[model samples]
Target chain A: MKHDYYPPGIKGIDGDYTAALAGNPNTGKSTVFNALTGLNQHTGNWPGKTVTQARGYYRHRGKTAVIVDLPGTYSLSANSLEEEVARDFICFAQPEVTVVMADATCLERNLNLVLQILEITPKVVVCLNLMDEAERKGLKLDVDQLADELGVPVVPTAAHIGRGIAELKDKIHSVAVSEILPRPKPVTYSQQLEEAIRQLETSLQRVYTNGISRRWIALRLLEGDHSVIEAIREYSLAEGKGAE
Target chain B: MGVDAALNLDELIEHGRELRNKLGPETEIQDEIVTSIYRRAEAIASKVAAQAGGRGRDWNKTIDDLLTSRLVGFPLMLLLLGGILWLTISGANYPSNALAALFFMLEDKLTFLFLRWQTPEWLHGLVVLGTFRCLAWVVSVMLPPMAIFFPLFTLLEDLGYLPRVAFNLDNIFKRCGAHGKQALTMAMGFGCNAAGVMAARIIDSPRERMIAILTNNFIPCNGRFPLLISMAVLFLGAGGLKYGSAIASLTVAGMVLLGIGVTFLVSYVLSSTMLKGISSSFTLELPPYRRPQVLQVLVRSVLDRTLFVLWRAVKVAAPAGALVWVLANTNIGGMSIIEHLAGYLDPAGRLIGLDGFILLAFILGLPANEIVIPTLLMSYLGAGALLELESLSAMRELLLARGWTWLTALNVMVFSVLHFPCGTTLLTIKHETGGWKWTIIAVLLTTGTAFLACLLITQVVQTLGLLF
Candidate 1:
């Protein structure tokens, strides 16, 4: 598919697709980014190495895809700078596909970020990185089962060794082109909080007509995230004027 | 466009605030969200992943268990440290002498060329003996050990063992109300203090970062390695000890441990007094050990680190050497400037178990610690600039001629370990702290500690000598 896709709100982008790489710290997120984009961002063996976002592009199947490597963060709670940056990009940048990378050796801890990303975007492919390390640790992951659980494509990869990268790129291309639709399972909260979120989401939907997720916006609002509230107000004002 | 929409948005924000207030504290909300996410992740992972036969996991656990165990960890650390020092000292000697011979031969050729051109005597002394000799001394002395030590240290870093060092020392730092990452920075200081100050950026807390920056100087940088190694070899390696290399290595390792001790003591004092704050908690992830990339380690350590530090030292040493030459040759009130200055400082230096020339060398070596021994040699030999002895025993004899004893050698090593950081480190501290205030505090704190420590040891030794 030769579909032209820019990041949702950013103008003047010529790429056919935009993909974001997200993961926890030291999960070889940059390795996957470099592998896909063919750019060498220095990878270190410690946490908090990538404090800022790095962007590059790669061509696959006659399509140019721009990939942005978001800062490695544990969650989307907006506590630290990396978290704020990661959350903002996922919420506002609106890339066509987001590949949430996770370490296969420590899947449980890494899946935390994967679940949070799924709550934000349905166009996500969980890249199970460090498969070599996982196998060495005697941990075997059923990729099909994981994909079924998350309702998204799961690609096993050893990014440093350049294994499974072709399949990962193909998955990204398909997901970006809407060839594979992902219906992610939303994180369930308490009943009272769920009621509050539903109420807020209805109010948000009334004001917002863009493709942004009202439920996610409502959860952020209930979490007292001022940045999300400000973003919605700006988006509503900008888009609502033309609609009205 | 409507006033009603803006009012509704304000109401929405107010509603959010209300909901948050109703849901207890923000931390509790965060904790609950994290708990739910973690719970889901655990469930999904358990469902999708299975554990089987033992492999790298078992060996990694067994190794980490021994490496980080309480009884074995400290001794292993010391042994590794001592072994690295032994390797560096023994490996560097032949190469250092060879380089010195080669450079000094070049110096002779330059002198012959100067004479053939009929250059003035004073000008020849200033150019060839002053700047050239100083640069030569620094390169021959510093390049070998750094070339040896940095790659070895980088190998450890690449093996992912440095974080385990931090892990082993974390509880001690926590007890001192300092960030555990300070141990990592201090480990970096073993290579260079300026880099150590920069490494303090890894620490998240401003209070702890400052504490780390301030106390990092207590550890000797690579610039001081040559001097420490030389002193260790001369003093401890004397009397033809059977394990001369081992004895020297132990001495160097003991100095390093002493430096670490002073780092902790100063960190404790700073945290409890000036930079007081609650110790922030962080997760130190011990990464899985990967086989080190030998080619990458060699390139990074040799080019990025070893050469970079050698270049900086040469830059500072050249100008400082010329200045020392001028001071040693210039006479005022019937004595060379250096001699006058040393005589003036001798009493105070003696109070701290150091002599005037040693104190003078330290003062002149402020630009770079690598030049300290060279400066002392120049002043003591009554030469216009730095000179080298043919062997370590000959160098010991020269010190003995100046009334040097084992106590003097011990005190000099201690003083070198505890003294103020060199010029680059001071500037780095200023830049990192974004002000001169903390840099000056760092200088005063380290220099004061060095003096106090030397004074205490000197007096105690003297009193014990009288009793004996």
Candidate 2:
């Protein structure tokens, strides 16, 4: 795949990185995006709050980085447009890193989106946003410990006040470049579902070498996700008759 | 798993359950694999996530629970809607009259200046009387209400109450076999029916989207509100000024509710016959409330919505004003053209519990709703040569002089609320449906519904000796 930041002819030029910014509804995903892009962004809420997507770009340490703002969805299920858009952008667009912006004031509910995204891509970062609001409610978080447990970097940010954004950018660049390793927390469904997923993932990984998480795709297949199956079929056909 | 994929999903799940049973559930390798994954994830989550203080009630969630409760939801929604309308109606009157007066005074000065310049008679009529009068009507009548309504509606939108409205009305739409998201589309209809029809594209199911498009006209568009309020004020609230505006607001809100009820009924009948399908499952997540950006909301909505509506009204109304001016001024047999037609329509109007003037108003109102009262005023006052009225109250007095009773006001209000949406909406329906058949269906449905409703209201009142 070609990267936009660096010309294709450049020698030893580090490839430009792409990151996805996702969050629960009203978790200040937009506030963070606006802060990164300096408010030179488009205006319009999602229709029926069903789906809204925005993209912003910035440079970090002389490497071009593009951040796609996925719609605020609670999970990556294909139940709503927001979820479908968010899920497709991560799996198909193949962003180098996916940042799940968690509401610090309501972390438990926000974690659902984070866990769901982590199940797809190993390159994940948890941004605990709205720290001010959390503090106002007398809550506290251990960012490093959270990072350690999830095998990913966690940053506390108050995007409205422009706090912790520099750290967020630096962490993203580092993670995307593989300078830091990510240890993702794996989730489980029912026993019967897990047995099916294990067999499905082994088959998928052996069949398509460069595709997204085989386990997540298997779970989607079980859930009757036609879009995912169509995606896999297309990928297989593109790889040629010999590859499968 | 690959073998199971070849089998039907139902049979596969059944086999999986049998395999689990034979492997003795807890001791089974499948159970251990799934449990270990969950256990590892939960352990990590537990480590970094500490109990933040003692567990206490979340006030935000509590308030949301009450606000979105099924039992209290509908009533609370109506109360808020009625309150906003009451505020707009009561607050907008003085400004609307003042604006009308100011515009008319400017028109008169322009007329004097044109005469001083010795402009040609037809040129003067077309420019000053026709073009300027239409712009003035669009500004004076449409501006104040839109200026007031859009901000209130945007405020509700920003406060995140609209999603809850969709949630609350899900059952009613489910019963109709239409998408629950139709509630959101109906809210958009209150702003503009064409926009509402456009918004219905969000419903994934074509059947439900069509149902939404077909029924969108039942909700009174912003164009019709001015007419509804005017009639309600003249008839229902005639007893006192403040009370009149309040009652007028309630009356318009009641009319809106009737439109919603009719939308559901029509959707139910259509789903059962023309478009049959089970309603798709939908889940609405309520976004957390935020403090509205007052300045941005005001500026954006005023610039975006008010201007958009006014621009359309002006474009359509100018040609209409010229046509109406010609109709009123061209004399035949000592009666101008409009009088001849109004006289012709009077008997049919009377049988339908309306007068010729009211019928003529609806006929002329087809181009744009902003001019219905102005056209009726021109007819009754013999002001065929002149273009604009000075005030709403003067117009009210003219109708009063022409034997407008409370019964007349009630019939007019009902008809205005139920009549076909404006020309733009019809064209939009045609565009969205992509067929003339559905467009014709929409036109027939709304106009037929309006005629039937007014017919019943008039008949019941007359037969009961309650109206004379």
Candidate 3:
């Protein structure tokens, strides 16, 4: 793939990939972020702890894997500062592989964020983190079953003790290189909302062809997200408004 | 209706109940929408995830319940505050005395060096005795207590108890028609009033944020810690029992509780009058308890807060010391300028149970609180004289020899707790408020409250023949 423009500062390594690590708050997301990057990104056991976005880089198989840690939030609903930043980064900045870290201890609650992101982009890896905490309470998970269910690679990780970080990075690298393809079965909301999204997507598909998913935009529109509307307008303008 | 329609309607009602439980039942439209989304998400979750080992209520929820319960919350808050104050009072005394000794010794050497260098007498006095001694006093008196208090406070913060404090106080704030997050901002104020004002930005509503900014000064800042400790020692340390320091610490902690009580009362009045608004509900997530990072918190708190506040006090104290030196040395009608000023303020001061010099010290001490005692000392023992504080007992003797009574100590304690903030805090309030109006209001309110409260206490004591 030919890159548009390299940053001014330096020479690039052969296989450098910049990834985004995102998750819901209290999901042990920072643990995974820190483990993967070999960085001590301050991990406090507190919700709303990581207010500022943090970045760290690691080299894997001659590729400089740079990861940005977005603030953990319950959803990409943009109800709070953390949500807005996380949602914007995923939609606009478009990281190569957005790794949605979820807590194995509370997988059900954590999946809401992952499912939302999957609607936006297919290039994703779900990190099942805090396996130790889950196991301590005698909870068992079939990782392959989860991966098959989500149509995305799911890696179980005890990130605090550095388990599964290597496999996670390899999976991310593979996904970024298009060696692995994700086929997410679109999560259906209520029939009313689904019909609205289908209508919006069909209308949007007639006008733009930059591979942007319209279903995501439609959900955002229904949610009354002004930023997403602005993003769509900006994208439309860049691709020539009203052009097929 | 079809089976699907019935299921959807049941789900919708279940969702409504969940929303009613989570957020309030008001704002029906928003609540309904949010509930629908959450219900859909929960339905999806149920299909894929299975609960194993019978997951109980969240530990965070349980802890929040215990900590924020009406019966336990206030007592727990007091117990923690008292414990921290006790640690600060006892931990700081030895180091404070040691620092004072070391700095005064250094001052004597510098004074001798100036004499040897053939520096002009007035210039030597201005440089060494005025500026240097003043800066020394601030660092010696203020640094130790801050070093002890900040790290301990940070430990509690790191342990995630601070949020629980906010959770506990959220109900009261809501009742008072203020944002619940005001409790978090007030906790920040316990470290520094300026930071507290900045933290008020967490509050979304302008009215509640303004209330937080205005009332931040009611909490004592780092600069006032030395005065509190010193006054506590002088008054509450009478008869010299082993637990004298403990008594002093308890007294300071009581003053802190009183400040918090006043903050709530003032915030209530303001919310009702000047800044009227309905209390907006906010989510206060009680984080899972974690073992505090002891070393990291200690280092960060000491370096970031303790030394930082100490540095500010030192900067202000240097000029203040020079000014005090000039005031003490500049003779007017056979007495120094400081003597004339003290005599002028003495009558009013006596009426409030404080003397002229104490009031004059307070006036000069506006820049930084660390130098207040040193300034008073300079006024008593001529400006050029060296302080030979041989012991804590000796230091006590000096004050007693100056005819200081329990009444004076009580007045100073009251003043320290209630006085207007130092210059830095005033400037911060101006910046935070974005105008002179609120700044002036903050100053006047705190100063007036301090004076009225002190005067009333003094009159009551005099009338009742209390030792104070």
| Chain A superposition TM-score per model | 0.85, 0.84, 0.83
Instruction: Encode model 1's per-residue lDDT on B1-468: one tens digit a residue.
Output: 545566777877787777777777767766667788889999999999888885656787788999899999989988889889999999988898888888878888999999999999888878887888878888888899899999999999989889889999999999888999999999989888999999898787899999999999989989898999888888877668898878888899989999999888989989899999889887677877878999999999999989998998888888887888889889898889999999999999999999999999998999889999878877776633233454456568888888898788888999999989888899999999999999999999999999999999999999889422
Ranked by TM-score, top first: 1, 2, 3
The Cα local distance difference test for each model comes to: 0.84, 0.76, 0.75
Q: Please provide the root mean square deviation of candidate 2 (C-alpha atoms, Å).
A: 5.4
Q: Against the true structure, what is each candidate's TM-score? A: 0.88, 0.85, 0.80
Q: Pick the candidate with the highest TM-score.
A: 1
Candidate 1 chain A: minimum summed lDDT over ten consecutive residues — where? A1-10
Q: For every model in order, what is the number of clashing pairs?
A: 0, 1, 0
Model 3 agreement with the true structure over A198-244: per-residue lDDT tens digits = 66565555443246577776555455444665554454454442343
- Report the TM-score of chain B alone for all candidates: 0.92, 0.86, 0.88
lDDT of 3: 0.75
Compose the digit string of candidate 3's lDDT tens values, residues B1-468.
233333433343344344334433335434444565556556555555565655532555677787889999889988988898989888988998898888878977997898899999999878987888767767777888888888889888888899889888888888888889999898888777878888887776788889988888888777777888877876676566778988998889877877888788888888899899898766665655667889999889978988877787777777888888899899988988988899899898888888899888988887766678878776776633454654455567777777788777878878877878777778988987888999998888788878887899899988999863
Rank list by lDDT: 1, 2, 3
Q: List the residue pairs that clash in candidate 2.
A: A151-A183
List each candidate's DockQ score. Answer: 0.47, 0.26, 0.15
